[model samples]
Every structure is written in C-alpha cells, then in structure tokens.
Target: MFLIFPVLSYGNNITLDEMLNMIDIKNFDKKIYDLEIEKNLSKEKFYNLDSYNGVKGEADIKYDYDKDKYDTNGKLTYGDFYVNISKNKISNDIDNGDSEIICGINKNLKNIIYSKSDSELKKLDYLKMKDKFYYLDKLESKKIDLINLYEEYKNNEFETKLKSNNLSKLKTEEKILKKSYELGAIPKIDLQTLQVSRENLEIELKILDKNLKKIKDRFLYEFNIDISNKTLADIQVKQIDISKYIPNIGERYLQSLDLDRKITIENINYLSYSNKVPDISLGIERKKETHNNTNSENRIFLKVSKDLFYYDVNLENEKINLAQQNINYRKENEKNISNQLKIQENYNNFYRNYIINKNKANLESNKYEIMKKKYTLGNITYVEVMDVFEDYLKFEVEAEKAKNLFNGYIYEIMVRGEKNHE
Candidate 1:
C-alpha cells in the first residue's frame, strides 16, 4: 500500500508515514511473525515424502536329531539289495539343520491417503498465515494508538507555551494594578483578583509541563526514540473525494478464513472415509532355504489391517457437525465485522468536525486581531484584549484537536488498506 505525504524537510523530523515504514524494520513482533511463517513453509515441504519406512530382512534356523533317523535313514525295504551301499553311513549322521532367509518391503496404502489429505490442510494453513502477513489490519490499529499519543504530546506542549506567555502578560498587568490600588485609583479587590488569576495560570502551566514530560517519556519507551530531540512533522490532511474512497473489507483475509474452514471440514470427511479403508500394505518377498537340498521362493503378498475396537462412527459424525458449525459462525462473524467498520461514515464525521472547528478558529482569530488594534488605540483596556486573546487561543487549541482527529482517521484508514483517492 502507498501513502502520499507532504514534501516537508525530514532532516531531523519524522512523519507518521515514516514511522509506519519503520515498523517492518524495527518491530520485534513482526520479525517473529516472519520467522513463524518461514517455519511453517518448511514444514509444508516435509509432508511430500512418498514412503515412511524402509526394507526389512528376516532369518530362521532350526537344528534337531531323532533316534529313529539315526538308526534307519537311507534304504527302502524292497530295493535294499540294489541300493544298500550307503545305509550304514546314513545312519551314522547325527545332526539335521535347515535355514531360511527372507527379504521384503511394504507400505500402508491407507496411511498414504491420509498423509496426502493432511498435507493439503497444512498447505492451506501456510497460505492463511501468508495472507495475515500482508493484510495486517492490526498494524493499523497500533498506528492509531501512536498517533493519539503523539498528538496529545503536541497539544500539551502548545498549551505550555500559551500559558507561559499569558502568565508573563498577567504579571505586568498585576504590577500596574498594584500601583493603581496603592494610589487609591483602583479597588483592592481588583488587584487581588488579578493575583489569583496569575497564580492559577502558574499552576496550570506546571501541570501541562508534567503531562508533556510523561508523554515524551512514554514515546521514548514505546518507540525507542527520544521525542524531545526529534521533530514531529505535522500530519497533512488530503483532500479526498469521499465517493471514490473504498474501505478495504479485507477480502483476502476473509477468503482465507473460509478456505481454512472448508479444509477442516474436508479433513474430517477424509478421516471418516479413511477409517473404513482398512490399513492395506503390498510387498514382494524373496526367500532362500538350505538343507540337504537348497530351495528358493518369491512371492507377492497383500496385508490388510483394521482397528477392531478403536473406530467410533458416532465420534466421526460429531466432528463433522462441529466443523460445519464453525463455518456457519465464520459467516456470521464476517457480517458483524462489516457492520462495525463504518469506514465512510467515520471519515465523513471527522472531516466535518475538522472543517467546523477550523472555521471557528479563523473567526476568533479575526476578532482577536481587531481587539489588539482596539487596545493599541486606547479604545479597549489591556485586560479586555487579553480576554479576547484567551478566547481565540481556546478555539485555536480546539481546532488543533479536531485536526488531529481528522489526520488520525485518515492514517488509520490508510493502514486499514485504503489508498488515498484525492
């Protein structure tokens, strides 16, 4: 997203947009979020493997001897006369042994199906995280908070200067009133009222000074910069065509939510079906045996396994129902969010207030100028001019506050994914 700000000298000054740009570079939370996204992407790649096990080998051996085998092993009774050469030697053999070895490899087909489905769900999760990284409205919310703090600091600082000037003027006026009272030209009560007003201004100035210090310290702690040394550039309000302005409904974020819910439902459905698909494995085995004669065999086999007691149909149905409910909740949540944003209405309201206050400040400013002229020509007392000045100052401060609100609103909208359509 792009934000267009005024061309002000930024040598020692920082604008709100500049601070926003710094978030990606300076914010620790954003860095952690980035690392988490990287880790998730790595996990997504790991689930693409085709097999989860390796080849296996097995061997068996047996050795035994029988008393009858040792005594009468090698000759048939009818043909003994022709084949009787080895009977004594065969009977003398004491031990018989057999050995077999088999080599095989196998994989569970059901597991493969389940893993593929799971991988898809993980992929969707990764995508959703990526969307959050880009369309981060939460960052905008943080910016709004910072803007308020900064504006408060500036307003307090302005008030301190105004109060100090007024106090100095009031001190001179008190000296004149004191001289007049001593000469019996003015009442003692008038001199006492001026002293009381001057004291009150002093107290108010002290409070303003304290507030300014606290706000400055808070800014330093939170943003890691001493606001005292750095200048704050004024927020420039753009002339926007309200009709053309569009508030970002965060479509990408909402779509990601919908997709996430769909994937959950799909996963539940997949699990239910996979439970019925029995664990099936296929393998080819090679066997070799040795005894008095050697033999070899090769076979292809299929193995099927089922969870005899672990599968629960009712639990699967409940899981599917819960997933559907979550989807429904998400839809309702989106509608509520739409109603709450009120971007256009908020913008218009702030802008209108700003204009009204600005006009009032201007009007009071003209009146104050006329009062100053009247005081110079001796048509008005210095006290009367000060009153007009104080009134104008109040309006001026209000106008500044209104401007802060207007600028803050625009800034929030910018971060909330609206572009300046001036």
Candidate 2:
C-alpha cells in the first residue's frame, strides 16, 4: 500500500474500527429506500399545494356606510335570503380547486415507475441484481477458499490440453521436414513456419493467463471483506418463483402491483361528483343621494350560477371511460403476463435442468482435467487435448448462465403476492 503522507507525521483522528464501522450495511439497500422516501416527499409537496397557494383567499371591502342607514335594523336583503355584508369587511379562505390532489397521485406513479422494483421488465433485472449480491456474498464467505485457490494456482503446475496438441503438431512438422529434406519435397524456409506456430501458441497461453488474472481480480475486489479471507464452498443454486410475478398479472388494479389504485378509485369518485350541482348566490344593493344629487334608488338582487356538462358530456365522458378502459387494458395485460408466467412455471422443470446443466458443466471440466493430465504425459493425441480444453471453457461459461436463469425464477416469487393480492 502506498501512503499519501509517508514523509510527514500525522496524528490519528479516527480509530480504524470506528472508520470501518461507519460504513453501514443499510447502504446496500439504500437505492430502493431512497426512492420510497422521495416518493413520499413528493406527496407531501403535492398535499401542501393548497396551503402553498394561501388558502384560496376571498374578501369583500366597503368604504363608507353609516351604521343606522346601512343595517340599523339588521334585516336581510330584499330579494335575497343570504346575509348582505354591505359596508362591512368580509373575507374567507377556501379550497378553489387548485389543491393538486391529483398531482400527488400522478407523482406517486411517476416515482414508482422510476424505482427499480417497479420496472415493467423487473423480473430479469431483479435476478441479475440478486446475482451481483449473491456473487459478492459467496466470495465474502469463501475468502479463505479463494486465497487457497490462488495459492494453489501459484505453486501447482498450470496444465492445459493445448500443450499436448502443440507437441503433436511439433512432432508432425518435424517428421514432414525430415521427409522433405530427404526427398527435396520443400525448402528449409518451411521449417520456420512450424517453429513460429509453436512460438505463437506459447505466447497465447501467457496472454490468456493475464486475462484470467484480470477476471479474477474483478470478482475478488467485489467479494472481498476487510476481516479475513475464508473461501466458502458448496453454493446451492437458487431458484426463482416465476409463478408469483406472473400470477401477479391477474390484478393490475391491485395495491401490490400498483400503489395508487385506491387513490385512483377515490379520484374517479371525486371527479364524478364535479358535475353534480351548481352554487347559487344572492345580493342586495341600495343607493342614496343628497338633495343636491336627487332621489336615491334601492335595489335587491339575486344571482345563481350553474355549470352544465352539455358539450363535455360528449368530450369528457371519454375521460371516465378512459379510466375504465385503462382498468380493462391493464387487466388484459395481467392475463397475458399470467399466461406467460404459467409457461415459465412449466419451465420450472428447466430450472432443474439448468441445475443439471450446471453440474454437467462441472463434470465436463473435470473430464477435461483428466484428459489434460493424460495428454501432458503424452498418453493422448494433441487434437484430443485441444478439444478438452475448449470444452472446459465453454462449460464453465454455460454453468454460470444456468445459475442466473434459476435466480430469475426465484425473483418472480418474491414480487408476486398472495390471494386477493392484486
């Protein structure tokens, strides 16, 4: 390790234990937690919209009025039943329909869509994420095992079937050159080609080792724990319950799949009441003039207001119908997803096969190992050696892929809920 202040002395500010302890395990799940918090925060902001706009303030102000002339009797207006506050200051605060109550619902939906768990294609991603964590967890458990593996690689011999293949090629080239020299079948220039081929193969193995070390380092860095390296073994292949998520397809309007279905139903109710009725208003007014002006006129007034959804019945019925259509649309999609889930559920048999493949690959690699040993001892032909080595690499990659597929199914179970779960 390189020290930043090797030449300078600095006092310790925090103990190593304290510094390490500061890194919280909670940080691992911070992504989902933070999104939920943000969603709620946006809801709080949406709820504050009414207060933020100052409570829909209303007031009536008047300049001049004598107590006796105005309402000394305190009688109600002539053509109105409601009290008239002429020459009196009146103010009221009320909701003016700017509450953004709807905004809160939309915002919640937006946040859910943004979060990882709520992704439409969440199944595969969920499994992949688990794999990352699982891989890390396994490595964490097997620190000692990993160290042993590394040590084994460092001291024990590196063997591959390729070497036997190269040796056979070398012998064959030598045999061909000897015959050519005797019969003048070809010039000495051809000998350089065979030598160069072997030289290239040697360089290729060195390059492959370098690449393998780079891959190992990436896995190690993620899996490493600061304490001790104890390599864990016997990892059980995990299975995903693809049935659960697809079963979730049955309820698009269900709370588990959609967090806001309840509020949406409420909103639909509220909006449904909007065109129910209109408010009416009554007013009274009186005017007086001195002898110099002329006679005074007093008047009583009544006013009524109403909003009829005549034109909108045609245009806006679509909106309510739209909600219904969406519910049905989502329901249909849920059915499709459910059907797909069943198909995947049947493939649960494949998950077993996936596990089988995982084990089979290991077996193939083991066979390659045995054949490699035999070839190295010159008991097998070079072609057989190359085939084994190539098969081993392919099997290793295939096993990892199969493990991931099983994980995908298991993730489905977590996302899907119980009866009436939607």
Candidate 3:
C-alpha cells in the first residue's frame, strides 16, 4: 500500500495560478476584449468633457500703414456663449488707444440634453465592462481548477501502475507455487491459498486499470496532453473556511443589472430629446475707435432656432417601454443568480465532507504500515497481510480522489463572481 517510486522532476511543472496567468497572456480573445474596454474608456472620457458640443475661439490683428491705424480683436465661443474684446489705436498727431470687452451666455437645449444622455450611456458602458472582466477572470480560474484535477488524476494513475506491477509479480509467484506443489515441494493447500490471493489481486488491478483509463481520457480531452510519460508534481491541499470564501453571486448579478438598467434609461433619454428641443445662443460685443475722437459701442445679441421636421413622440414612448422591459429582464436574471448561489453552497458542503474523508483515509494508511511491520516479524500469515494491504490501498485511492474534489471546490468558490482571488 505504501509503495515508493523514484522522484522525477520536469521543467514544465507549474503551479495552478501560474498556468492561469500563462493562459490569460496567450488568449487572443481576452486581448481583444481588453482592447474594446480601452476603446470604451476613451469614449467615456470624451463624453465626460463639459464642452462636447464643440467649441472654438479666434483672434485677429490688423495693421493699416496708410491710415496709420492698428486694430486687435479676440472672440471665444462655446455651446451658446460668446465673449468679444477689441482695441483700436491711431498714430498720427494724437497717440490714442481705446479698448472694450464684453461677455454673454446662452444654451442649446437639444444638444445639451443629448450630450448629457450620451455621457451617461458611456458611463454605463464602462460599468458593464466590469462584469465582462470579472467573467473572464472566473473562466481563467476554472481552467486552473481543471489543470489541478488533471494533476491529481495523474497521481492516481501512477499509483495504479505500481499496483498493476505488484499484481503481476504476485501472479508469477502463484504460478511457481503451483509448479512446486505438482512436484511435491509444497502442499496443495498452499498452492490454493496463493491462487486465491492472485485472484483478488487480479480483480483489484482490473478496477484500477479502468479508473486510470477514465481519467486519462478526460485529461486528454480537456487539456490535449497525453500524460502517459508525464510526471506531475503533487498538488497541495489546504483546509479553509468555506463560509468566509463563498462568492456573493446575488450582489454581482445586481451590479451588472444596474448597469444594464442605466444604459436603457440613457437610451430612452436620447430618444426623447433628439432634435426636439431648440438651439439658443446669447452674445455681447463692444467696439472702440480712436481716430479724431475716442468712441465705443456695446451690443447684446440673442438667437433661437429649432429643427422644422424632427419630432418622434411615438418612437420616444416606445423606447421608454423598452427600458421598462429591460428592467424586468434584469430582475429575472438576478433571481436566477440567487438560485445558482444556493446550488454552489450545497457543493461547498459536499467538498467539506470530502476533506474529512481524506483525513480518515490518511489515518487508515498509517495504521496499515504498522500492520505490515508485524507481518514482517512472522506474526501474521501471508493471506492476512494481503487483506490488510488491500484495505490500505482502497483507502489510499479514496484519499487521492477526495483531495482532488476538495481542491476543485476551493477554486470554484474562490472565482465564482468573486471580486478578489484567494
């Protein structure tokens, strides 16, 4: 039951976390998703600016040598506001200059409302990306769990091979015992006992071989690794408090749903205000002239304009209805996540029991070693020793399976809608 084999090392051996990181780095789809998120972030920033309606400014300087006059003027405008400043100078008999400045403000109700809605939509898009990134993280974590399962399967496979070799040796010994009995070198009962032992070993070996094949097929299908000649390092198992680590799936679902609702609402707003409102602008101007006598003039200006044919009341109402439908859909999705969380909680309990079983199996294996020492001292018959050996092997196999199950559950809990990895 406690067979020893030479240790093998390979440079390809990697931890579960390291394997996940490698997969992420090499994944083309993940890279594409990240690039899309970056593009959305840039759009969000563009919309978040205060002057999304496009702003411009201009300055002009003029010189007239024949008239011996100079003029400087500057104007700044954004959305519905404009400011103007002007200075004029005369250089003849009188070196005189005049300056004036004016500022005004107004609004384009349609563009302002549209820009606000657009910014909100961009913000919602950014929030949705949070869930997308989280989903990719969970996928990577699941891959790690699968790789760890493969490693455990390989460990069981190695043990099965050892058992098969031992069984073969026992069968050879049984054949020799039969020959000795025929030659009158050993008793018939001794040969019979050896035959019985060989039969039991054959049955156990067959079961082990079947189990090994099942694991091998699964490993190859999932990871495409033949593992026949591969040596996997032992995976470490640790005890953890499951309740403390269970993911809050309901919370995560709600957050994603909130983003969806916000996006829908923003779309409704954009539909309701698109080209329906009027564009207005206010301006102020002042001019000063210094020719024979200084003179200044101030003016206040206002403009209001509206699109003649861009109204869609029915479309706006339809969009609002669609937003309501989206909210309802999100609520239903959240309910589904709640149910999934319950299922995951049950799985956690099952894995906890697996860990307990693993500990019990380990204890049984240690006891079997003591029994083996007693048998070496000739206190027990060979058949009795083999029976204890069979029991110990059974427990060892159970322990290996339990360890893999527990590790898988730990990874599932750590990555399922979790904000932080453990």
Candidate 4:
C-alpha cells in the first residue's frame, strides 16, 4: 500500500503519517490481530500435513512358558498405506523347535476422500486472515482521522487566540475614541461603531471558545490523548489518482462464493461417502504355526463394514441450502461495498474541491494587508479596513476547517483501499 504523507513543519517536526504509523504499532487491537493471524497460519500448516489425523502403529508380543510358545505382531500405517508382520514359534517334548513367519500389506482407500476438503478449508482460513488484516488497517486509518480532527481543533484555538488579542486592541481603541468624542475631537457615531464591533467580537470569541472546548473534549474521548499542549502539523493537499488501486468487488465476491462452494462440495462428498460407501480394507495375510507338524498358509482378504442407519438426507439438504444462502449473502454484500466505495469517492471529490476553494479564499484574504495600508494612506474608510479584517479572519478559520475535511477524506479513501486524488 502506497501512502502519501505531505510534509509540514511543527513542534518536534513529526509528520502526521509518521505519527499515525507509530501509534498503530502500539495499538492493542493490531497486536491481537497479528497474533491471531500467526495462530491461524500455524493451524493451516498443521492441517496441510499428511499426518494431521495421526500416525498409526501397533505391536503385540505373547509368551506361554508351559507350551514354550512365542508370538509377536507389529503394524504401521501412514495415510492410505499399512504394513503388518507376525511371527510364532513352538517347542515340543522332543526338544525340537520350529518357527514360521508371516508378513502382509494393507491399504485404506476411503481416508483420502477427506483430504481435499481439509486443504480447502485451511485455505479459507488464510483468506479470513487477510480480511482481518484489512480491517485492522482501516482502524488505523480512522485513528489518523482523529488526529487530523485534533489538528483542526488546534487551528480553532489559534484563531480564538487571535480574536482575543484583537478584542483587547479594540477595547483600547474604544476607550480612546470615547475620550475623543467627549472632547469633541471625534464624531460620537465613530465611538458607537467601535463599541458595537467590540461587542460582536466578544460574542464571536465566546462561541469559538465553546466550540474549541467541545472539540477538545471529543478528541480526548476518542483518542484518550490530551491535546492541551500538543502541536498539530499542517496539512498539504496533493493530487493523486487512485482508480488503479481500487480492487474489483466482483472478484472479492467470487472468492467468498468459492469458499462456500468448496465447503459445500466437501460436505456433499462426506455425505455421499458416509451414506453410499462402506469402509473397506484390502490386505494380504500370511500365517505359520509350528507344532506336531509344520504348517503354513497364505491368503489375500478384503473386509467391508457399513452403518445402515447413518445417512441423514435432510441434514445434508439443509447444509446445502445454508451454503447457497451464504453465497447469496456474499453477492449482496459485494454490491453494498461497491456502492459505499462510490459514495466515498464522491465525498473525496467534494473535499478536493473544498480545499481548492479554500486555498483561493486564503489568497484573496492576503489583500487584507493592502487594505490596511490603504487605510493608513486615507484611501479607504476605517469601516472598510475593519470589513477586510473580518473577511480575512473568516476565510482563515474556514480554511482550517476545509483542511480538516480534506484530510478526513484522504483517510477514508485509504481505509477503503483506494487512493485519494484531487
């Protein structure tokens, strides 16, 4: 995943992306999800092994001292193949002893039927891990958005401080204007205008203070971080094309369908094997005995066993129906995600335009200094100068909000596994 982090200078000179990445490393949910993926990978490896069911081996030994007889048997099995060996010996009263040996091979063909389904299920588990990782990535993106919002709140604080300072300066101007009016050096109308401007500034400052407190409280509630002393880095808007990064929702939907299909197929196989097929073992056996006369026999045998009442047709049909329902649900979910992606893309575009407009406004607001110079040169009225100041302040505050919204859109695009472009 390519993430664009525009650089900005702030206290300690840390970029927002870097800070978010660092915070993600310490996220408890991310750690837990990592562990879960590791655990699932371990399980996948275990299930892929041929001996996952278990290695089978058996040995037996017998001795009868009164008849001086000895017997031994051993067997080993792995997957569908098995080997067996047995030996026996007998001694008679004439002090003569005879020994015989037997060996044979056996194979089980039924066990291989389940291996394919088991492998598919393990693969599905790995896919689920990918989903979990994606989810965690989105969560981290959301936290980055919170950081951006906090930055906006800090901008609000900055604006509030500027307003407070302006209010102080206006108060001093109001006192001087009042003295001038009383001394008949200035018009009473000018003093009334200053008084009204001061009152409006005070009201606006109070509103800003209330909003700033609310923003701080929300930031604390969401991120558990006190931003009272924190310095937020500035944001720079960059153009990027993310269309190529958008994955096909249909393909993801197909993956989900594939999982359901594989599970259904496995279950069908299981049901068919259980209901219509009998467990069978094929082997060659050899036996030998030593007694009054030596005797030996070799035979090949096949054994079959069946459970007549084991079939559950209704249960099998129910499982098949459930699998179909899962496939349908996945298809609908894919459509929903596709729609959501479109909506998010639209939102990003809106923010991109918003940033552009705000930048333009900021450029226009720069003319406020020119207006101030005109006022000093007696080219513009005092009220005109104050109007310019108000416009500049309004634009400045709105530009901060626009940056916040734009950054939020960027984060949303990232969470959706898409690129945010201007």
How would the candidate models be sorted by lDDT, starting from the highest? 1, 4, 3, 2
Backbone clash tally (model 3): 0
Q: What value does the lDDT take at residue 414 in candidate 3?
A: 57
Q: What is the alpha-carbon lDDT of model 2 when measured against the actual structure?
A: 0.43
TM-score of 1: 0.72
Q: Per-residue alpha-carbon lDDT of model 4 for 286-330, expressed as tens digits?
A: 777666788889888898888877758765795777677676877
In candidate 2 the C-alpha lDDT for residue 390 amounts to: 56
Off by over 4 Å in 4: 1-11, 45-107, 116-144, 147-151, 154-158, 161-165, 168-172, 181-230, 246-277, 283-301, 306-341, 344-395, 418-422
- Model 2 weakest 10-residue run by lDDT: 97-106
TM-score rank order: 1, 4, 3, 2
In order, the Cα lDDT scores of the candidates are 0.64, 0.43, 0.63, 0.64
Note each model's CA RMSD in angstroms.
Answer: 11.1, 15.2, 11.1, 8.2
Best by TM-score: 1
Clashes of each: 0, 18, 0, 0
Show model 1 residue runs off by greater than 4 Å: 1-10, 50-100, 110-138, 241-246, 249-253, 275-279, 290-294, 304-341, 365-391, 418-422
